[model samples]
Target: MQSCRNCPCTSRSRARTATARTQRSSRSCVTSTRAGSSYRWTILAAGVVAQASFSAILLGLPAIAPQIRHGYGLTLTQVGVVLAALNVGLFVTLLPWGIVADRIGERAVLATGLTGCAAALVVAGFTSSFGGLVAALAAAGALGGGTQSASGRAVMSWFGPEERGLALGIRQTAVPLGGAIAAGALPALSAHISLRAAFFGLAAGCVAAAAIGTALLRSETTKADEHEDASPPLRNPRVWLLCAAGTFYVTTQISLIGFLVLFLHDDRGVSTAASAGVLAGTQVLGGAARIVVGRWSDRIRARIVPLRQLALALAVAAGASALLVHASLWLLVPALAVAGTLGLSWNGLSFTAAAEAAGRRRSGAAIGLQQTFLSGGGIVAPIAFAAIVHATSWRLGFALAAASPLFGYALLSPLAERRS
Candidate 1:
């Protein structure tokens, strides 16, 4: 193996490439040593940037949903279809990408997946018809989904367990950064340029991410990091419980945060900018939650207590918000903001719980199963809400949102007892 002394602060991607060449020649499994490696930290920074790009694809289109609806003369179902297209990309591709990440190592999978997102987002930007849009979104989602699982795995490998929450929290910050950026900026971008241009901008950003990812994504010391694993059966009870809890947490999250702006505009009759501000603010609030919750998870022995407290708090917030659906247009800002704050912030904690529940050896698959459950909610909830909006109104739809957390709480409550 080439000494770290030679490259100085060489990029992990280059390191990986060099290691692979060395292994082929020597028929050995030695990974690049981390001696004198300042560049490893740069990889983490790049991972953060890549995550932001991935998040933009998920949230950018929704920011311009109103314009798209008007331009296309779309019905509620069609609007749902557009939103669903993005989530569908996320849902269907998440586990498959996880499997791939396990097989190839994170760097190769991350580079390929990001490039796919760039191409697909560009296609989505130009597509005119619904079918064309769907195809592009799915492709973007397939590529984009790989970032989360693979990135999380990469961070885990890069940093040891104690630094994990901080490292992972930095990675998780992409969720809010992407959402806040799209929510605040895309509408303005759409006003001056076309929505397509805004998408092109994101496409450009993702391309930049891909280039960095290609250079940074190499490291495969552990056997688990070298090969992808198939979908294994759930042998542990904690995995199943986490799956159930994660479903509820994500269901409440995706349904609310995903459509927070619409809920403000349609249900409360807020202005578009105000709605965007609310969306942006909600992301900021949730971003803080990821850091706070993640750090808290690190200090505490039992993450379940904090998570359960958060879940129960969310249930109360959601229930109260559900009641306030018809109070007045003015009440929604605080209601939705608080609801979003508690609703979506549980992810870091839950993911931390995944590491604890399944142990590090099986953590990737455990996380994949939880993510699959989370994404499954993305498929079902919006469709149901669309039906509700068509038949009645959003107030009833808001009332119905409580069901998932109630279910999530049922599963998550048990975690406190079983926490290691």
Candidate 2:
């Protein structure tokens, strides 16, 4: 009845009521995303833990190689085979894991994979037979391979383009950090306690990493932009080139990691504990190198150029280490340190270039593809280096391994002309 002139009270009341409703809706929609929202550092931490889980079995083996070999009476060739088995598992699973990460999301894939690895390692710890132990390790590698793609993908998604290189560099440090920890702990455990206990300790680490990954990993819900959505990373030629370079680089790196302790202890007559300590120091320096290179790449805004230079540097270092292997610790230590630093430092730079080239949406799949090549190299490097060592000497084997990075440097030099 009070339709027009007398409706001031009604209008004001409706306006106030609408304003209150808006405020309530806003509050209701404000979900606590702080915990779930992706931070560059948080993603980096998750990536490190996931990467560490993957490295523990492989990297730790070199530290405890003598104990395991003596315990099982395994030949150097057989030891090499066992090492290759883990890479075999990684090579088989990388691409599939990448596809899964692209489809189901990185969080689920990493959590599920790391959890499975924990179980596999537990089985490995209890197994008495060397064959059984190798099988379990291979299985664990397959299960844990998802982290390679999933963690990198998470970093690519969370960080901006300019910062991804440095972010990934920091994330990549987990691999060496894991190696350092394993180097420090595994040899002591295998020597003092038992091989089984060492494996169980590694299993426990994977379990903790899985729990952390599940809690911290965030899933991407928004659609990607045009570049990321248009072409699959596998279709990009840049990715293939990066993968090619990575394969050679990984070959050289795995050889150094796999055989450094043995070379030190056998050739230079260093104690096992001292040799493991040196390898651990190398991993620490390598980790530092990654961060420095990554930051430098960010500063220059060029990835491939630095990668080429690093490859060349690695070649020189490897060659020098080969020549200096039988020398005194004063010479050998610095040579190995330089070689390890340059050899292990290339991954972050190449990975950043590959991921950027693949675009964000397809980064998981691309990283998986590239990692497959790297894993393939890992499979071959150990066996090949062992065979060469058996046929000739550790010096010759390292000399030969140096050629790989030289080739990688040659292959990647052309990329410097193009944008990274």
Q: List the residue pairs that clash in candidate 2.
A: none
The global C-alpha lDDT for each of the candidates, from Candidate 1 onward, is 0.72, 0.85
For model 1, residues 1-420, the per-residue Cα lDDT tens digits are 467556656667778889989876544332222222455567678777888888876765667777777766787777777777766777777777766776677777777888888888888788888788878887787677778777766665555455567666667777787888888888888888887887788888788887888877766354433453323526777778887777777767766776777767776687777888888888888888888887876677557788777877887777777888878757856887888888768887777677546554445566666777776776677777777768987766666775667777777765675644
Native-to-model Cα distance after best TM-score fit, residue 301 in candidate 2, in Å: 0.9
Q: Count clashing residue pairs per candidate.
A: 4, 0
TM-scores of all predicted structures: 0.84, 0.89
Using alpha carbons, what is the TM-score of model 1? 0.84
Global fold similarity of model 2 (TM-score): 0.89
Candidate 1 residue spans exceeding 4 A from truth: 1-41, 220-234, 328-330, 359-362, 417-420
lDDT tens string, model 2, 347-397? Answer: 988888988887777888998999999989988999999999998998899
lDDT for residue 270 in candidate 2, whole number 0-100: 85
* Cα lDDT over the full model 2: 0.85
